[model samples]
Target: MSNSEPQRQATVADSQAITVQTEHGLYIDPQALSAHLPALSYRDNELYIEDVSVSGLAKQYDTPCYVYSKQAILDVYQAYSDSFASLEHQICYAVKANSNLAVLGILAQAGAGFDIVSRGELMRVLAAGGQAGRVVYSGVGKTYSDIEFALQQGIGCFNVESISELSLINEVADQLDTPAPISLRVNPDVDAKTHPYISTGLKDNKFGIAHEQALDVYAQAAAMSHIEIVGIDCHIGSQLTEVAPFVAALDKVIELVQALADQGITLKHVDLGGGLGVRYIDESPVSIADFADALLPKLTELGLKVFFEPGRSMVANAGVLLTRVDVLKPTEHKNFAIVDAAMNDLIRPALYQAEMAVIPQQLPNGGMQADDTKTWDIVGAICETGDFLAKDRVLALAEGDILAITGAGAYGFTMSSNYNSRPRASEVMVAQSQQQLIRKRETIEDLYRDEMRWQDQ
Candidate 1:
């Protein structure tokens, strides 16, 4: 009965029994919703993000827009910063979550570093005013140009995933006549117990060097003149509902660090790459503070600079996908609420089978009957049968109703596409009770803005 065990058990219990009944499916249990989305509330029967009403945002931006609470993003970052205040650490926000320049700008201003996987992401961090020396590049397949670009920018370090990549980076650094900071991303073979699509710390996954070979890799890295071995890192996976996997991964990382020290390969930092999951459905993820409390005692004993790359935990609950019901169709086997927002706007549901809370801005005709509580497959206008935001969702709604799909801040717009030539949606940030459009809705012309029709022969 450790201190965190009871808390974990309680959260699991709460998630199991609590379901806020809606029209057909259940909204996120209020307890989990409040824990994750502290800035959201219902006022005048309308869902609001911070002080901006969902109704008002729909009216102004039209439907199928992204609405975020500026405060929510700040709050989550502050929680991480405050919880580890006593430690030497850097909260390197994973940029792939939501790379809207404004999102990056806000994080950069808050003294957050960045974890980038691509050269374009490196440019975005710089464009958003993030310091070059605070950026950490992580990915398995960084190209020659990627290595050249990162070295030119003088990034903090590269979380090298393979020996080949280390050699390539060394070559690039030598070509540029500079020392490149390197951190071997060791595959700890720990089961993150998450979705297969995201699990990265296993031996079979093509993410990092194997755990047993990490010491040898460190020795190889030390032999390279252009490589400055700075740190050790491992990311198990994303959307982790429990803290045990992270702890397991870190324990292995620490063991390797000691082994490397015995070999005279001293490290500067220990990067516990972030995959802390947020409550999307019935998940009871460890709170950032509790997670830190669980690991800080051991982390402090190591006395090395700590680095984190939290993505979803920082932004998933801060934004909502605002969509409008376009039409309702009922058949013998199913009821459908087709929305204007399609798979091109948010792909998690179709891709990952992910679930999110879909709450109507107002109930159908402001009321619902027992029969009106029919379960509806909330789908998008995309032609694919798989194009859905949520299936068998219970929601009280009308044809023209607006729905806020909660828990969409991370991996939402960043994963969006222009498939079917559908223009992407706009984005709005609500702060201090005021709304500002962060991204403009793409126009039909913008879809073909760069395409040129071939001349007739």
Candidate 2:
């Protein structure tokens, strides 16, 4: 089928049955593919992301690049907006997940306010055409200058973390002669039941104020001359799969909101910081519809504007890291497939022990034969032993074969680095058959352009 031709949905006899496309054939399970990814599918023995061939992108962009489906992102964002359509809510796309200007621009144009952590993120949101009034500043550390910048921009609210940070914001606002819109991020201490590293609501985590101290803190904020308590905020953690923890957290937040209201502190909104999970493997995350169904009623009863700071769920599965196998080594102990993309290119696998689904861009004629497949450790070129992508993955592979690392759109490039002095990869956004290079691949000199040379010194 041509790239411009609309893809026909394949009917399946059973959910597990692999649907064979007779015309321009390929053995693919459409149901299984849809369950994992939205805009990706197999056609003519090649994987296509929104009708744009993944292998074609690898060849065009020259491997070790990030490719995102524009439609996928829009669809996901639309789903979130549609689910909460019944409520007075704002779906603030968390900019920290994937801060690429194009991604930001897409979300901004689609009416997504941003949840930023720093001045730089706020600037990025503005540069991408997002309104400062729709932005919510959030983080543990906010320097005087950062607070001043955000205040100058007239951001919607500040998700104040600590009491000291709250004081700092008030101090900056006083100097600016402006009442800074704020939200005290309360630590509900509700276990998000996610990875410990990503969990932020626990008392031990340095994210928000203790749940018990929220009312007292609000009293403190209420007394501050320059601090305007516009709302309350709480983010338990990232990659949360279940709805119980969210409902539990909301219940606590509601209780606190009522207590504050009783104290004559009527807030305008409630920021239920987002941690909705996406399917990285066999995991069944709560659907956006289900999430809204779980929390919308309580929020409606509260009769306050709602704000969701979704990061991963907005873009994680919308993009992939495209890399080529540079070398294949077979040893008695273990088999290793070293790809050009390293930990510096995508670090979640190393940092969070995240397991991303690695699949070939192009499949063999009749899929992989038993002899052609082997259990291989997909390692990167980085020097660290922890620099690995997938472990003990059974796949039909060869040197020079292009692979797509799924679930890379969120923290993949945003958390990447130039470790080992390796240039960062380029980023591309695919919309149907058309492709656009959102970011250029970094050059070796680009890395040290701002550094003072020893000879010059």
Candidate 3:
């Protein structure tokens, strides 16, 4: 059948059971793919994100493109907002998750604030029409220029990580003659029970001030001339699946807040840093509502403004990385499906040892039929041996078949690099079946645009 042809449903039966063929013609996996991917479905034997075909997107935007569903993003953000409806809060979409201008614009329009870790991110938020008063500046190493820039922008608050950072912000604010609204990101030392790399609240991790030292730090901050201690914040880790750690961290934060109040330093808000995990493979992470439900009561009792810095939970499932298989090499030991998208396009698989869902853009009329299936290692074109997307994944794939790398919306493009001098992929956003190219694919000439060859003697 042609790539654009409509899919016709078919059924086959055996003595044991009968299997129904979906639009993409997969029969073996009985579970609906749509259940996992809310915005994804098979239409006419082609993968459709909402209403647009993935193959059509691949053809139009070229492979290795990052596609996002606007509706999906809105839905996730709204879930967070609705969950905290009873409380005074701000859902600051972490800009690092999917910082495409179009993505930021959509969230900004949806009344979502931003939690930024850099001045560039702050600038992106501004460029995307985000309100400066709604942006919170985060990160451990905020340079003088960044501090001065954020202060000038009238940002909502600075999530100060250290005493030294507080001193720096105070110094910068003094220099700028502006009061810097700030919060101390206290390390509650709560176990996030997640990957060590993403864990931040542990005492050893270099993220926030120690929980024990936070009261003294707050007292010190209250005396600073140019500093206004606005809130208390804690982030345990990224991709957190449980609620106990969050509650534990909040319990510590609440205690600290009360201690500070006794010391005549009352915070106006409390920020529970966003580390809620999303479903990547077989893992079942906490739902947004459940996560909020677990923490909102305590926050309400504290009677302070609440802030959530959700990055992955807000965008991870809203997007996929589209790549085309270049060749299928069957080796003596293992099989490899070499694809055009390398670690440069999506690095979570390499960096976090992340397991992502890999689905074919088009499935055959029947299932793989056992004999046709092979356990293939999805390797990328990057030169490093570690440049793999998935290993030992059983799939029936062929050359030129497009694959959707699921759970790629977060930490996908933002972590992308021009390694091996390869240009970065373009980004597209789908809103109501309309495809919008948010970022143009990088060109060879675009690389090193700022570099100049020095004349040698």
Candidate 4:
């Protein structure tokens, strides 16, 4: 007989058995990692979250499940609150962060306002029982419906992008017979030091009005009696970790605000759009307190109310995506592990090449074996060749195991699509000792809920 003992098979019953020696070699407290999931412990070569094991969640809820921790959400939100406690600020939780109604409702209950870009988002916030009066609308292309909705809701304000948009909003408000609160989304032209796809503060991006022209736009917006210039806004980028860019933008914005004040348009609020990054893998984001300490005093000194639209930073670590391994294979040059969750479910890896911490239901009895622990390209069953989650990941995993993709709470389900006619997954919110199914799993009919296939074609 071999010296090594037979390992416990990975299954729903074995969820807590895998002690996180290291989730992808990143040092994390096993307690903190499993604190949100109480019954989880490492033993017999597997992992478990409380009595309901990782594989167990897969069996009960099926694969490609989205699991959220209420405590984690509260903790992260509280972190932001604590960070900016010393300042006159309000965190308008970017509804785009995990846009799940339940998720939004959770944050809303914690007293978070919203920053919405689309009418659909506005509807979501409302449907989730979010307060509309506290919501602020931002984005360059605000459709008529979006404007009308924001006006009807009487949100805090709209971060307008252009002079034409300002005029259009004024016209809409006039026709609607309602005064629309507006703010100029200034493209501050500062290098946010972030990914290009998410960078919005640059001069060339299709996000905000040029900083040089912001004064004119503000002047024009101020003249419209139907449009009240309540604030000046700028979003440099998303997933940013540095404070220098924000300080730089604030310096420019303060100058403009001073200029506008000289022209008799005193800004009531200064909306510094969100770009704070969170820890996904070893990426070290600035502490919430540090960010606030850097930003709040600057705005407080200016004597203006401040608004922050944070998306990823608030909910990125609040939850994870659970998928079951379908198959595993090895070739001459590499290894492969196919999971049930597809790119259509979480697009960050494919869209932005973002890195995440991937953990399994249980690791093998032996420590990471080089040959067995090959660099696997984690893929999904989606039809597209681009339907991959991770490339060259070294994990000692086997078939039928569950893989927990970290940092999925924010953009995963929010960006999901039915790309190959695949049904969306269910989402569960874990609060206290109880787990609730906030969203039900999709059935075959859900896949065709919007498809009107008339046989006449």
For residues 334-382, what per-residue lDDT tens digits would candidate 2 score against the true structure?
7899999999998888888887778788878875565666667899988
Off by over 4 Å in 3: 1-31
Query: Which candidate would rank higher by TM-score, 2 or 4?
Result: 2
Each model's total of backbone clashes: 4, 0, 1, 19
Q: Which candidate is the best by lDDT?
A: 2
- Native-referenced Cα lDDT, model 2: 0.87
Q: TM-scores across all candidates?
A: 0.93, 0.93, 0.93, 0.89
- Model 1 C-alpha lDDT per residue in residues 43-74, reported as the tens digit of each score: 65567788878888999999799988888898
Error of 1 at 382 (Å): 1.2
Candidate 2: regions farther than 4 A off:
1-14, 17-31, 455-457
| C-alpha local distance difference test of each model | 0.85, 0.87, 0.86, 0.78
**Which residue pairs show collisions in model 1?**
24-394, 24-395, 25-393, 25-394
Q: How does model 4 fare in lDDT?
A: 0.78
lDDT of 3 at 307: 95
